[model samples]
Target: MFIKGVKILFVVLLFYLMTSTSTTPLEAYEETSPARRLHKAHALCTLNKSPPATDDNDNEQIVETFIRCMATKMGLWTDKDGYNAKQVAKFFNKHNYENEVMTIVDYCNHQHQQTNLDLWAYESYRCATEGRIGAWLEEYYMLSLKL
Candidate 1:
């Protein structure tokens, strides 16, 4: 009888663990990320401030829309595979995805939020003199300014 009880408990524990597992690992990790979206209606804008809305999914336009939508301040929306602040850190630390990260940062900072964007801009400015977000802006405030 005791053995049967132990087996039942173990089965229950295993079931609980299985149920807790998520199908979309990307969605699970970004459930509560501090990102937001920033974009203008009608005319989409890329992180580089280029005119947006191309057929290409990875084109500047789509990226601009995604970043603007998920920016921290706007809190408008987010997607499972969209960019975020973590990606910015990765780009800065590893020089990986530099263009994508910079564009996303500029897209968000320019339209939606400020403070965190500012911090990232500072970091971006110090790291590279000719990268996406920091270097692409027209003036110091536009590029370096966070909010």
Candidate 2:
């Protein structure tokens, strides 16, 4: 009889342990979801400037859109119009910038620490506009990797 009582108590304790292991409300509230962070970043970006005027032949607008899309592809923005890595690679291939794009992808993917998304977005835009992405890719990789 005592052994059976112990077994029942053990089962009750186990059940209590399992059921009470859920996160506290404070913990749940403190942790921001990745999707929410992405949305906030996108909102901040949009609030910083007016939308660029659209023109089919406007090279500057085209490049700006491409950079912003790249930021989204890097998981830094919530914009629906952004390209993924594969699409960005295709774009680079079409523009004959495939090698530079490859370098950028490798650097961004393999860095030891997280890159500052805002700084990266800004630097990428600068490099894209200056037609010096290859150099910027190398520099960014070195700086980010501390190598």
User: What would the TM-scores of all predictions be?
Assistant: 0.19, 0.28
Q: List the residue pairs that clash in candidate 2.
A: none
Model 2 scores worst on lDDT over the 10 consecutive residues at 11-20
lDDT per residue as tens, model 1, 43-71: 23223344543644334233333333323
Clashes of each: 15, 0
Poorly placed runs, candidate 2 (over 4 Å): 1-70, 73-85, 96-100, 108-115, 124-147
Determine which window of 10 residues in candidate 1 has minimal summed lDDT. 34-43
- Local accuracy by lDDT, each model: 0.36, 0.41
Task: Say what the RMSD of model 2 is.
Answer: 23.1
RMSD per model, one decimal: 21.2, 23.1
lDDT of 1 at 10: 41
